[model samples]
Target: MIDTAIPHKPNPTFEGLKRNKVWLASITILILLAILSPAQARFSLAFTLDALLHTAPFLILSIAIAAWAGATGADSLIARVFTGSPLLMIGLAALAGGLSPFCSCGVIPLIAALLSMGVPLSAVMAFWLASPIMDPSMFVLTTGVLGTEFAIAKTLAAIGLGVMGGLVIYLLARGGALADPLRAGIGNGGCGASNLRTPQPVVWKFWTAPERRAKFGREAVKTTLFLAKWLVLAFLLESLMLTFVPAEVIANTLGGTGIGPIALATVVGVPAYLNGYAALPLIGGMLEQGMAPGAGLAFLVAGGVTSLPAAIAVWALVRPKVFTLYIALSLSGAFLCGLLFQTWMGS
Candidate 1:
């Protein structure tokens, strides 16, 4: 049985959010100003609202999943899944990450929990780096938009890159090259419930408890606000690019194949790729405009790894060194995947 007699602790994440509310509010106000700007008057309020509404379900699902995972005996289950072998754990964790329904952001709570429970950071890195690249729904959407080959390649890349990341971290940990893989300070951040003082005694039957619901509600509010703040900024930037940037220019810049375009695709993909779901049609449009299939793959993989919201959630969870290593491995794997897929497409 889990302990119910727990004391209140300062939720660093929530407190940090509260402190940063001013910045968030400032960004919101700026977005409104941009919308109301006479030069930008034609900018659609509907577009901004649609983006927000579109992401609502994902955000909600992230929070609920976090809450449920927190309340369950998932820690033991997660640990049990990995035997003593580091390689096996890395392979399985990466595979689990790709197969799991959770997104990069939604799994934050669970990752935090796992790390807190002494789960190998290397194993978690494998899962973390891979989980966002593709999921079942994302897979179906990619196949429909990009074709079966691309989708399958992406799924494979997610797993492969995850393993690579896990192994790199594993070696790093073994050599004592890095310290504190799980960055200290941020507690229970992301879609996961904050201030999880205890695992709530009921474990599996969590829905029956008032405390669980309350915890869920608290996390929901914070996650929504945190995501919304970054999203508004991202959307506003996207809108400006759509309005002012020319498709022809983009096509010319990223439309080619080979190493140059592939490298650009990987680098630009970090900012270019929006949330995974919305990126499909946008990518399809780019492909129609002569964007190389390999470049597109690079963009998708890199973007998923480096997207603002997901990246922020990760930065909050881990130290700067680990985060930097993650970005390097992700982009490296993304480029390699793009190279392989590019050759396949040309063939």
Candidate 2:
């Protein structure tokens, strides 16, 4: 369980700068570019700014939706879907996971809470599988960067992966394969456990209350800052990639409409994925450089679920068997999604 508390320290500004590593990295990259090639640095700055400006509308809308959900307490309602029959719960959980506002890391505490409350691991697995792949914000950002078709395909993939994982886990549980899914001391408590355990009624008109309005503002600002840093870095990296990486190289590696490219992409995604939001511009750049659509989808789906932070959280929370199952399901589902999408694109 992640502690939400912030410990007081001297030199708070320095501490904040230390924590903002992404921004620091972005700055460092810019400084190096300026020193090594001022012309390239100017081009990168222009590219990043242009991309950010083009994406501003989507970014604002995404921020509003996420902030609204947080302030109105609608996120807490996700737990309600896990109470039905196993099949129904799994379906609803998958759908909910796709639509929910939670990020990969953000969903961990909720998953821990659900498991602690005796919600079926199958349902939780469904949500867990899907939550990292697509959220409302991610969908909007993806559409802005990749197109509506790609975003919709990714969302469907997320739900499909969830349902597939849920069914597999459900079948395994029936055979008494996964009797205890959680780690020894995990699931007992988590940062957001209380909210899931006893959900509060949502206030749809969040602005009607002062506190809710304040909450909305805070959430909006927090989400904006979070997204801004990643996206700025992403656009910078994308500009550099477009300038430095040869199109033929990308095409040769990830461009072919074959299982090999897609499988390779899935494997590479596990370790190479930066951040869900950060990856969009890079993927967009790859596509422009002739990367196959299927390979792109496979990479995004695999990385979204099994990124380092997300993978670590799952590993720390669940038993080795469950963790292994999660990785297996993620890889297989990503490959299958890629294959089907490739076939569809060809047709």
| C-alpha RMSD in Å of predicted model 1 compared with the true structure | 9.7
All candidates: TM-score: 0.64, 0.95
Off by over 4 Å in 1: 1-80, 186-248
Tens digits of per-residue lDDT for model 1, 1-347: 98898889999877775787645554555567566774553363455567668656555565555545545534334434444688899999998777665645457887887677667888988988898998765675566656788889999989998999999999988988776667766554444533233433336775677876666566557655655655555555555556667888877888766788889999988987767765665666577667888888888988987889888877887888888998899899999989988988788
* Whole-model alpha-carbon lDDT for candidate 2: 0.92
The TM-score that candidate 2 achieves is: 0.95
Give Cα distance to truth, residue 147, candidate 2, Å: 0.3
Writing each residue's lDDT as its tens digit, candidate 2 over 1-347 gives: 99999996679776776889999889999999999999999999999999999999999999998899989999888867888799999999999998899865468887888887788999999999999999999999999999999999999999999999999999999998988788888875576776677789989988999999999999999999999999999999999999999999999999989899999999999999999999999999999999999999999999999999999999999999999999999999999998889889989
In model 2, which residue pairs have backbone atoms overlapping below 3 Å? none
- Candidate 2 wrong stretches, greater than 4 Å: 1-15
Computed on alpha carbons, the lDDT of every model, listed in order, comes to 0.72, 0.92
